[model samples]
Target chain A: MVSAQPAGFGHDTRHELIRFENVSKTFELSDRTVRAVENVNLSVARGEFVVLVGPSGCGKSTLLNMAAGLFHPTSGEVYYNGSLVDGYNLKTGYMTQNDHLLPWRDVVGNISTPLEIRGLARGTREARVEQLIDLVGLQGFERSYPSQLSGGMRKRTALARLLAYDPETLLLDEPFAALDAQLRLNMQIELLRISRSLNKTILFVTHDLDEAVALSDRSVVFSPRPGHIRHIADTPLPRDRNLTTLRHDPLYTRMTAELWDLIMPTLQETRGEAS
Target chain B: MTNAEIGYAPASDEKVAEDRKRRMDKARQARTRERVKLNLIRLLMIGGFFALWEFASGRLIAPFFISAPSAIFRRLGGWIWSGDIFYHMGITATEACAGLLLGSVFGIVVGTILGRRPFLARLLDPIITTFYSLPKVALAPLFILWIGIGMDMKITFTAAIVFFLVFLNTYTGVRNVSRELISILYLMGANEMQVLRRVVLPSAITWVFAGLRISVPYSLIGAIVGELMASNKGLGALLVRAQGEFDTAGVFAALVAIMVLAVIFNTAVRLLERRLMPWKSAEQELEGAV
Candidate 1:
């Protein structure tokens, strides 16, 4: 099936990027039980940019984190390319909400960290690092430490780090939630462009509806806190999607409105509204 | 704003900017190299101090109580050549090395276990802290009595001193690990052993190394104290015998030997730490910014 996809399948009909098979997660907090995610079943295809969007405290981040191997479901399995994920395989790169850059490393060194961990030769690592640094528009900031870089620059460096290792899949858990509005917009566009160009599968988590619409092939709207899957809305945006045109599309508005309606009731329920 | 108004200048302008950047980068590299050179110079200054002290004592001042550097070197050279220095150094080294190995091993294993397991951490918290806080050096006489006037006494003394430092550092390391990081490792399919080896050990190594660096000097002190009280062959015993006979120069020479050995050992440990922890710099930089 995997070999057939590369040779015969249409670009959109490529093999599933990741599959969550009957996943459930539970937590025992001081004898007080909490069911975090209940029976989530979904499959994301190769090169698809999927966003798990919901209000804060929902299991959106948890779902994305599970895909990153940062959290395991209490039951069921997560399969990548039809193989079960049992441990951190390093094949999928994860970007955390807070940019977890090692402060002592310079921008180029930070980007090349996974290569260092994999024990790549210095000469090859340096060449790859330079390529990533330039791709992220951090060419001049190679020697600068994370401490010296602005928040936006740090995030950019982190993104470069994610791309440096050429992971087939990328999982982002509210990666740009800490950025200001303008920077977030810029980053979202860059991220989308990079994802499409690299043809990498991405599972991005966010609470912002506009961001989900802006970047995702499909946006999965989740229920509020201790979430269940509410709806998965697919956008007919092309692989070469653009921000300027997305806002102009009537279809974008229609899908966003549908997802917003799904989220509104859940938000009201969490807020204990009489309605 | 228009693209031109946003100052999307020609590629040549950007290339010029890049050239300036290259120069600045070279300057920064040079500065870092200079800083390392300065640290080496400071090390040489310390050596220079001992040389001046030896020359002034032997030539200018009376050499009765103060030993000349040359004289001390000559004595050290004879001792080394004839293997007498090795005998004394070997005794103290054996005690210190054994005690350090046993104590650090016990501390890391026990400390990490207790730190990770909440029930155990809570159960032993008070008792562990109390014993750790108490100065074990003062109990050297008691240890000598317990283990008899042999190498056992020195080993026990060194072990007692080393244990608490390593235990506290390792405990702090395990306890301070990022909760989010652990969850990430688990989600990655890391089992208990993998988590310990990949996550816990690496996370705790900085603290364990810190503890090791601190406890090594204490190990030396503990062994010396044990020798002073009862041992017949270690460096401490040599110093005691020299002092009893009013051979102050001999005592000073012994003290100099210990200092040189200590400095060498400490330097080697620091070099080992640098090789092991390539990740440490990033963490430090993050902290500095915070």
Candidate 2:
């Protein structure tokens, strides 16, 4: 059960970093109105990794955008640290599905952009960039431009850049969706390790049920367009779970199965419409 | 064992080495032959063109108007021998280069300002369109009347022509930057100026270079047309003088000089593009392949 916290105050302010209080979003096009999400209430605790899985066009990304302060909810409010997020939230970093790496800059240049914006000293920036490059397994590609990099390598650069300014929370929208299966698994493992080590809160959006189970402390499933939360299940796996061995864990399997079962009819309806 | 004894054993490394060497030699020979064939065809084409021109000038048309290629080359050689062409060339070059530099700098500054201020850009869109629609070359005479029949008029006209071309491209380039990228930067705590410097400017540079590349010939045309209308010096003046005297060879010589200058200017911009935006070139190649 989710409790409706007050707009300005929460009982446990220390743990709850991001709160959506009955948030809804609608787009008013020229001829029609599209209700993207409806009356969704959720809270992400400090250092918690939460994933949202739903059917296509189910407004998972919209939810993340609201948390990032890039979009305002139609009716309710999104709160960050017990304050209404009215403008751009500086405490969080957003990584979209597209790498959005500055095409003109090389890997090191792109990764160090946030530091440069903050006017960090040259030496310190270089050192931090070097560490991130090493962390992302992009040591040899520091001087290579984004256009020259493969999809997975570009994703790694994006991840490094997102971590550059050390935002307390990460808002990622299917960052690894473009990667191959093996690379996706590797990135997931790396992400889990990094999140645990840094203790950063993360709100991830993905359509993949298995990824939701493998990456998140809790998985939230939603119905199709005008999306609302259908089920919220905590992963039964341990905190230090390995991505490679997650499929074999009974809890991971059961959690993914439960999520799939909840969203199956929506997915089939979308598929039927497409066909 | 019996088959090996009858010379059916595995081949020695020396035989494989010989085969590889022969293949490489054959490939080299083929490449040389291809180069020679291409060169020969090019030579034939040029020679045939000149021979045909010579025949047609005397038979099909008046030799007075369409001077033969030999006469054109002779006039070109005479200009080189006398050194008068250099002075005229230097004047035109100064006008074109100065106008190009000044106009590009001005265009980039104004375009960037307008691009960042969407309110101003929308307000002035119609006025900008009207100015752009006015025949720029037709204003050369007006510039001559205001600035006098000197190099100043030509330079100003050239700069005016280059300005519009670069401005529109730079503005579009800035406006075309992805909204998603801007939002990401904002979430990263980038203020307006930081966003402009780190994202908008660098992203617009490729378009700026493209505009520069296209403006080279227009800049030359602007200068030459201004000179032809009323100027004491420049290749365009030389052409006008030759036309008045009915020296077709001199006219051809001046035209050829302009062509050569255009080629040099184009090559310089291309080289600068390669050096300055190496990433863009690589990106273009990837897009081409896709």
- All models, RMSD in angstroms: 9.0, 8.4
Give the clashing pairs for model 2: none
- List candidate 1 segments past 4 Å from native: A1-14, A69-72, A75-77, A103-106, A143-145, A244-254, A273-275, B1-156, B179-202, B209-221, B231-290
Cα lDDT tens digits, model 2, A27-109, are 99999999999888888889989998888898999998898888899999998988999989999999878999998889999
Q: Given candidate 2, what's the lDDT at residue B108?
A: 88
Candidate 2: list runs displaced more than 4 Å.
A1-14, A272-275, B1-44, B285-290
Local lDDT at A194 for model 1: 78
What TM-score goes with each of the models? Answer: 0.65, 0.89
Where does candidate 1 chain A have its weakest 10-residue lDDT segment?
A1-10
Model 1: how far residue A143 lies from native, Å: 4.3
lDDT string for model 1 (A1-275, tens) is: 11211211122435776887768788789979777876677788888888988767677766776776657889988877878876564567778888777554678877776676556899999999988876656766777766566677788888887777767888888899887765676677778777877798899988788888878888777776567667777776665665756778887888778878878988888787333
Which 10-residue span in candidate 2 chain B carries the lowest summed lDDT? Answer: B1-10
How accurately is candidate 2 docked according to DockQ? Answer: 0.30
